[model samples]
Structures are given as structure tokens and as C-alpha cells.
Target: MIRLHHVAQTRSFRVLWMLEELGLDFDVVPHSFFDRSLRDPAYLALSPAGRVPALEIDGRTLCESGAILQYLAETRGTLTGTPEERPDWLEWLHYAETVGSHVANLTQHHIILRDPAMRSATVMRLEAKRLEKALEGIERRMAGDWLLPSGFSAADIAVSYGALIGQRFTALDRLPKVSAWLDRLNARPAFQRAAARDGAAQIYMQAFYPPPEETPHA
Candidate 1:
């Protein structure tokens, strides 16, 4: 049986969406970031870092979302992209983390740090800018509806997760291409199925978390 440890609105959603795209039958083991369940020993055994997207499949477990995507694609012989496009495919897959890093920092400052004093306005603004820059990269690279010229592949699923969630922290007003790409992704039947099962928002409750307004020295 394939089991995916998932937390709604987290990177785990990448794996969840991938499974749906592959039309695989799997079970989602729901988890919560606020509940401290991730710190438990049992869950820790599945994911040493106490993070989400730990997938159990083929008698082994994989924690990293990109790795899991590659494994599923390679083993399933689909969504791997043409052999000639492997280099671009790999680049986009790993680039997802570049987008994810800023998202994590923004999420920490904007949400996890409940106390206003504990949060840094500088960091929030900086990360949001950095996240915007990352999205800009995608906007520039997007020559077509998907990341690759070949067609939709796992790379789209991997990197689009950041764009989907990153918009919460960064504005997409200038990112017309990225915004359009997201609209296309959201319309996919598989993405719709995944969203239907993605449970409810636990981490990102706000529609937008703008950076703290800048202050001027008198």
C-alpha cells in the first residue's frame, strides 16, 4: 500500500498532487504542524527531520519531495520527460527548493512567529522580495504553458507548488506569465483532485501576508 504523510498547504502537497497526476491509488496520512505530532517518535521514524511529504512506497520510504517525484517518475516510466530533456527537468525539479526556501522563511515570520515583536519586518520584506525574484525567474523561463518545451511533466508539479503558495507572500501583479501558468496548473484535472483531498488550511490562513510597512526615521 502506498501512504503519503501530508500536511495541507505544505510542500507535501507536491507529492499529493503528483500521486493524483499519476492516477495512483494511495492513502494520505494527514498531519498538522501545530499539533506537535510531527515530533513524535513514530512519525520521526518515517521522516527523520519531522517534516511532511514522507511517502511509503515499494517497501521503502522517501522524505524529500523532489526525490520522491523523481523516483515515482522513473519507476512509473511517465512524467520523466524525454531523455534529451533530462537536464532541464532536473534543474527545474531542484529549483523548486530555491522557491521553497524563501517561502519557509516568509511563513516563519508571517505566521509561525505569532508575537509581533518576535518577527522581523526586515526579514519579512527581504524574503518577500527574494520570493518575488524567484517567481520572476520562473516567469522568464516560462516559454510555454509548462516549465519545459516538451510538455507538462513532474517538474511543473514540483516548482509550481512554490508559485502557488509563494503568491501568499509575494504579489504576482508583474508576473503575468507566472500567474497565467498557475491558472493553467490549477485547471488540471489531477490538480483538482489533489486539491479536493488536500484537507483544510492549517498553516497559511491568510489570503495574503504582506510585508510589514516600512518605517522612516524622523
Candidate 2:
């Protein structure tokens, strides 16, 4: 069975969600970011950066949410696009990583964190625009329900996770297709189970954020 070292409120939720989607029973070893438990030696052995959502399979350890999604897709074969659709699937997967990372960075740094004194307003504005363009790019291609030519796959999972994280910035209102797609994805029973698992971990992380500043503001 796969063992997931999950941090409650992070991208690890996506991994748990994917596993549930696959109908695979995996073990969860919850780690808390608030206590900095992720940086502990044991967890660091599995993830060099002590990040959440580390997966233990057989004996090998896997980190990074995108890689985990790909591993699951390739391993299960069920999360795959058709033969002719492979190129498109691969493209969208890359899109998720490249475009999604930018989106998450903007949302987390600017919107979620109360770092007005620390954040760069100019940079955040630029990131927001970049994210908007990326969303528009995806919207142009998302003619059908899924992101790829074929049905739902790992590519969709990866993109959906990115979309959910970044939704705080764009909202479904600005991107109707993406919103509709997320609605469809979330409606899945498996996705709901995954969400419940991820939500449990997130509730655990609420204790971590809003760190103390180096110099107290006068």
C-alpha cells in the first residue's frame, strides 16, 4: 500500500485526492507544518526539502505533487489519455506545472499571506496578470469538458489542483470554463473523498501560517 506523508493544508491534498480517485486504499501519515515536523530527520530522509505529500511506494520515496500525480497515472494506467491523445496529455501536464506554479505563487504570496509590508505590490500585480493570461490560454483550448482531447486523466488532476489553489485570485466567475470544469471534477464521488482527506490535513495546517516577523513593527 502507498504511504502518504501529508501536510494538512498544502498540495498534498491533491495526491490524496488522486489516490481516492484511483480507488486505491493508501495509508496516511499526517505531518504538521506548524510544528515544523516536516523538516525532521525522518521526514527529510523521504523528502529532501521536508515538504508535504511525500509518497512511499514499495521502498522508494517520491516528492513533488506533480511527480506524484504522474507516478499514479502511469502506475494505474487508468489515468491515461488515448494513444493519439498522449501528446496532448503530455502538453497539458506541462502546462499544469509551468503555468500552475506561477498561479500558486501569486495567490499564496499576495492574497493569502498578510505580508503587505513584505510583499512586492508590483510583482504581485505582474503575477496576477501572468496568471490571467495562462487561464485565458487554457480557456481557449478547453472547448470540451476536460483539458485534454480525451477524458479525465492525470493531466486533469494536476491542472485541477493548480486551478483550485489559484482560484482565490481569478475566481470561477472570470474563467467560466475552468470553473465549470472544477465543478465537474469536484462533483466526482472519488474527488469528494479525496477532498475530505485533504481537508483534514489543511485543518491541521491552520496552526502553522502567520509566522512572527523578525523585527516587531512599532
Candidate 3:
């Protein structure tokens, strides 16, 4: 059986959603940032970085959600798109991390550093703007219901993972197309199934984490 080591509401969700989309039967081995479980020696062997979404598939191991998704597309012989469309497919897939970087920074400011003194106000504001700028690219590019004109692909699964979490940091009201795209993604049954299996929230506890203005309040 395909085994997925995952952390709820993270990049691992990309793998979970894609697996559901492909109708592949797999088991979810949930992990948490709260616990030291991910730092365990065996988990490190699966993902040297100690990151989640480590897949034990076909008797091999795969980490990195983007690589995992691309591998699935290759094995299933779909979602990667034709030769002409491959570049665009790859762009958005990696761009997911572009978006993820800001989210990670913001998550550090607004959530990870529980003490207000531990967070940086300037960083929170700067990262939020950077995140919004990255999202604007998606807004301009989203001329259709999905990221690729060829229709739904792993690119969507890869990129949209951030949008789901990003809306919490940078408001999507200004990013209407991306917001609508997120709605479409959320409308998918497979997305729903993966979400149902995604387990309860861990890192982010609030619906919205507005940018930090001024300096840290003492």
C-alpha cells in the first residue's frame, strides 16, 4: 500500500489532494509540528529535512511535495500536460514554493513565535506585501477556471495549497481571480476528501492573521 507521512494543513495536503484526485488508495501517517515525532531518526531517514509528505510508494520513498506530485503525474500518465504545456506546468508547480516562502515567514511571525516580543512587525508587514505581490501573478494569469488553460492539473494542486493557507495572512479580497480559483478548488470532491482526512489544525489557530503594523507592543 502507498503510505503517506503527513502533517495536517501543510504542503502534505498537496499530496493528499492529488492522491484523492487520482483515486489512489493510500494510508495517511499523521505528524505534528507540536510533537517531536517528526524529528525521530526513522522519520529523518524518510525525509532528511524532517519535513512532512514523505511517501513510501512502490517500495521507495519520496519527500518534497512538488516532486511527489510530479512523480504521481508521471506514473499515472496525466496532469503533467503535453510537451508544449510542460513549461507552464512546471512554472506553477515550483511557484507554489514561492508563495509558500512568504506563508512560512508570516506563520513564523504571527503564529510560531507565540510571544509578541519574539515576532518582528516589519517582517510581518514586509512578508505580507511580498506574499500579495506573488499572488498578483496568479490573479493576472488566472484567465480561466484553473491555473492552466489545459484545465485542472497537478499545478493547481501544487499552487493552491498556499492559497488555502495564504488567505489567512494576506486577504484575498483584492485577489478576486485567485479567490475564485480557490473556491473552485474547494468545490472539488477530492479536495474535500483530503481535507476531511487532513486532521485538525496545528500551527495556525486563527482564521485570519493580519499584518503587524508599527512595532511590537510591550
RMSD (Å) per prediction: 0.7, 5.4, 1.9
Identify the candidate with maximal TM-score: 1
- Using all chains and alpha carbons, the TM-scores for the candidates as numbered come to 0.98, 0.85, 0.96
lDDT of each: 0.94, 0.75, 0.91
lDDT of 2 at 167: 61
Decoy 2 TM-score against native: 0.85
lDDT of 1 at 143: 57
**Residue range 1-218, candidate 1, lDDT tens digits:** 99999999999999999999999999999999989899999999999999999999999999999999999999989998889999999999999999999999999998999999999999999999999999999999995988998899999999999999999998899999999999999999999999999999888888999899999999
Residue 154 in model 3: shift from native, Å? 0.3
Candidate 3 per-residue lDDT over residues 1-218, each given as its tens digit: 99999999889999999999999999999999988999999899999999998999989999989999999999988888677889999999999999999998999889888898898888999999999999998999984998888799999999888888988998988888998899899999999999999999887789999886675559
Ranking by lDDT: 1, 3, 2
**Poorest stretch of ten by lDDT in candidate 2:** 203-212
Which order, best to worst by TM-score?
Answer: 1, 3, 2
Q: Which residue pairs collide, candidate 2?
A: 8-201, 8-202, 9-202
Q: Please name the candidate that would achieve the greatest lDDT relative to the true structure.
A: 1
